[model samples]
Target: MNILLTGGTGYIGSHTAVALGQSGHEVTLLDNLSNSDTAVIDRIAQIIGKRPSFVHGDVRDTALVRELIKVHSIDAVVHFAGLKAVGESVAHPVDYYANNVQGTVSLLQAMQAESVKSLIFSSSATVYGVPQYLPYDEDHPTRAINPYGRTKLHVEEILHDVAQSDASWRVACLRYFNPVGAHESGLIGESPRGIPNNLMPFIAQVAIGMRSELQVFGDDYPTPDGTGVRDYIHVMDLAEGHVAALDYLNGRPGWSAINLGTGQGYSVLEVMQAFERANGCAIPYAIAPRRSGDLAAYYASAEQAHKLLGWSAKRSLDEMCASTWRYYQTGV
Candidate 1:
């Protein structure tokens, strides 16, 4: 199958591109290099022995998207292009909405214009907002609190309405939890442009002497370690989940949201400890107040994912740390 991956040069998209390539599918990457590097395409080629065709453009460009779809004879699309930082979104809601929400609308419009209906959307567990219950399922209500989460929720709502209107649309909305780690090859990984917003990258930089002590946000949360807990799924596992989702979407006509996670929550301290164990270095830290809209603990049920896509996260916390550290040491 020929697949078009939006944001394909980014972290999860790069890994998924490798997975798709290894699985005997053709992939074309569409990215604007906003939060990623173009050299990643070569790294992907080094890993998969074939470089995916890349288009340097934004998702909001509907005309370019339609041209790419038609020119590449795209069979399906795995949409991952958007602004993703939660805190940044909180400060810049309009930018987030324009890139995430409006961009998705443009992509859907292009797909509709080209008569391509199969799509795999890069949704987020943030759509669940402050979880009404632990281990959020697909049925969980979407009360996204921040602008970033709200953007994802808005896109999900758009997809839902599109599916309801057209039974031919096969959409898989994979709600991802915290995605960490890197490919085992150490050639490609998450490379945030500025100061890392996520935890693992911050810890990696600190371990690699690029940064000093880590900041443990709010040790007063209601958790075992008094810090916030989250389900950190390995990037490779998350990548494979996309392949599984694509396979499941083959000839299947329906709209479905599935949780992609390990179904286990780990505290910030536990992650630091695991990183220390993985890299053989202590991550010195200081506790800070919790950020607004931060949840104490939340993970995924993941049963529906296993049931529908035959996928489950298999990497341990130690592996996630080790692989990430390896990539950090190797340098992308």
Candidate 2:
């Protein structure tokens, strides 16, 4: 199948590109290179054995998206083009809505115009804001607290409504948890433009001596280590989940949201320890004030993903740390 991946050069998108390419699918990557680096394309080429067809464009360009679908004969779209920083989203709601929400609308319109329906949206676990229960299932209520999460939830709603309006549409919104680690080859990994927003990358930077020290966000949280706990999934595992979602939507014509995460939750300090053990180096740190709206502990229920898409995270925490260190040692 010919697949189009929006924002295909970014971290998760690049990994998913490799997964899809290895699964015998032709890939066309469309990215504006907003927060991503062009060198990622070469890394993906190294992993997939060739460079994918790339478009230097944005998803908001309806005409370009339509043309790509028509020209590439794109059978499915994995939408990953959007801003993801939570703090930045709070400060710039308009940009978030325009890029994340409105951009999706434009892509959908183009798909509808071309009569192409299969879509896999890159959603987030933040949509299930302030987890009411441990191990959030698909039935959990969605009350996204931040603008970035709201944009994802809003896009999910739009996809649902689109499927409701037409049974011919096959759509799946994959809500991802904390995706860390790098590819086993150490060719591609999370390389945020500036100060990383996520925990694993920040820890990686500090471990590699790129950064001075790691900031432990509030050691006073109600967890085993007195720090925040989270469900961290290996990025390669997350990439394979997308392939499974695509396969599950082959002949099915409906909308479903699935969680792509490991069912285990690890605390902040626990991850630091794991990385230290994996890399054989110390990651210096200091306890700092916790960010507001940060939850103490939350993860996903892998039952639904296994039951629905036949997918589950298969990498260990030690592997996640080891792979990340390998990628960093390459000076990527």
Candidate 3:
């Protein structure tokens, strides 16, 4: 199958490109190089032994998306292009809405114009804001708190409505948890520009001496160690989940929203300790106040993904830390 990934050069998208390529699918990467680096294209080629076709463009450009779909004969799309920082979104709601929601609308419009219906949207677990229960499933209520989560929720609703209006549309909304770790080869990893918003990268930077010390955000949550707890899925596992979703979409035509996670929640201190053990380095840290809208503990049911897509996260927390450290040492 021919697949087009919207943010194909970003962390998860780059890993998924390799997964898809290894699975014998032709991948055309379309990214604007906003938060991602162009060097990822070469890294993917190094790992897969074949380079994916890349377009240096944004998803908000409908004309370019349509042209690319026709030119590449794209059979399906895996949409992952958007602004994804929770704190930043809270500060810049309009930018988040325009880039995430409107960008998705533009991509869908282009796909409709070209009669390309199959789509796998990159949704987030944030949509299940402040989970009423411990583990969230597809049936969990979506009450996005921040602007970023709201954008993802809005796009998901739009996709649902599109699929309902036309039976020809096949949509898979994969709600991902915290995606951490790097490829085993250490060729590609999460390299967020400027200060990292995620925890794992921030920890990695501190371990590598890029940063002075790690800031433990609010060690007073109701979790085990008083810090917040989150489900962190290995990026490679997340990538493979996409491949499984694509295979599940072969003959199916409907909207299916599945959670991609490990079904286990690890507190902030647990992760920091794991990273220290994995990297054999002591990380300096200080306790800081918790950020607003941060959840105490949240994870996924993960049963739906295993039953529907035949996928579950295979990497352990230790492996996540080790792989990330390996990539960090590579300086790429």
Candidate 4:
């Protein structure tokens, strides 16, 4: 299969590119390098033993996307391009909507023009918002708590509508849980531009002595450890899930949405402890008050994905931490 990936140089996208290449599919990476480094392309080539074709451009550039599709004869598209900082999104809602929602619109239009209809979209569990129920499934209501999440849910709806308008479209919205870990090669990993917004990357920074300490938010949560619990899926497993989704769409002729998660929840303290063990050091930290929109507990059922795409997360938390640590250690 010839797969064109938007934001393919970013963390999850880079990993997915490797997975796609290893699975006997040709990958063409499209990225503007806003939040990621171009060096990741070389690392990806090292991982797969074959360099992928790349186009440096924005997903919002419809003309560029259409040209890439026609020139490469793309068979499918894995759309991972978008701004995804929750707090940042709250501060800049317009920017969030324009990039996450409008960018998706442009990509879809280009796909339609080029007759490249197979698409795998990157959604988030945050679309569930506060979670009216625990263990969110595909059927969970989508009441997004933040602008970032709202953008994702909106795109999911748009994809559904497009598929409905044309039966030739095949779309899968993979609602991802908290994605952590790094490639075992450590050649490419999460590289936030400034202060990290997510936990695992913060832990990695602290472990590498680049930061002072970890700040555990709200230790008084309703969870067992008095901290918020979340489903942290390894980036590699998440990448594999994208490949499976593309394969599933390859055989099918309709659109669907699925959750990509391990169906397991781990609290913040538990993750800190695990990282401590992984890095051979105690991570200093202080318990801080809960932020405005933090959830007490959120995880995915993943049963639908297993049933539909025959995919489930296989990496344990220890593996997640260890692999992430390896990436930071190698400093590649």
lDDT of 1 by residue, 21-99 (tens): 9999999999999889899999999999997999999999999999999999999999999999999998899999999
Model 2 backbone overlap count? 0
Clashing pairs in 2: none
Candidate number that wins on TM-score, 2 or 4? 2
Residue 221, model 2, lDDT? 83
Q: Rate the local accuracy (lDDT) of all candidates.
A: 0.94, 0.95, 0.95, 0.91
| TM-scores of all candidate predictions against the true structure | 0.99, 0.99, 0.99, 0.98
Give a tens-digit lDDT track for model 4, residues 188-217.
888788999999989988888999989988
Local lDDT at 175 for model 4: 93
Residue 273 alpha-carbon offset, candidate 4, angstroms = 0.6
lDDT of 2 by residue, 178-214 (tens): 9999999999999898899999999999988899999
For model 1, the superposed segments whose C-alpha errors exceed 4 Å read: none
Would you give me the overall lDDT of model 1? Answer: 0.94
Candidate 3 has a TM-score of 0.99
User: Global CA lDDT of candidate 2, please?
Assistant: 0.95
lDDT of 3 at 208: 93
Off by over 4 Å in 4: none
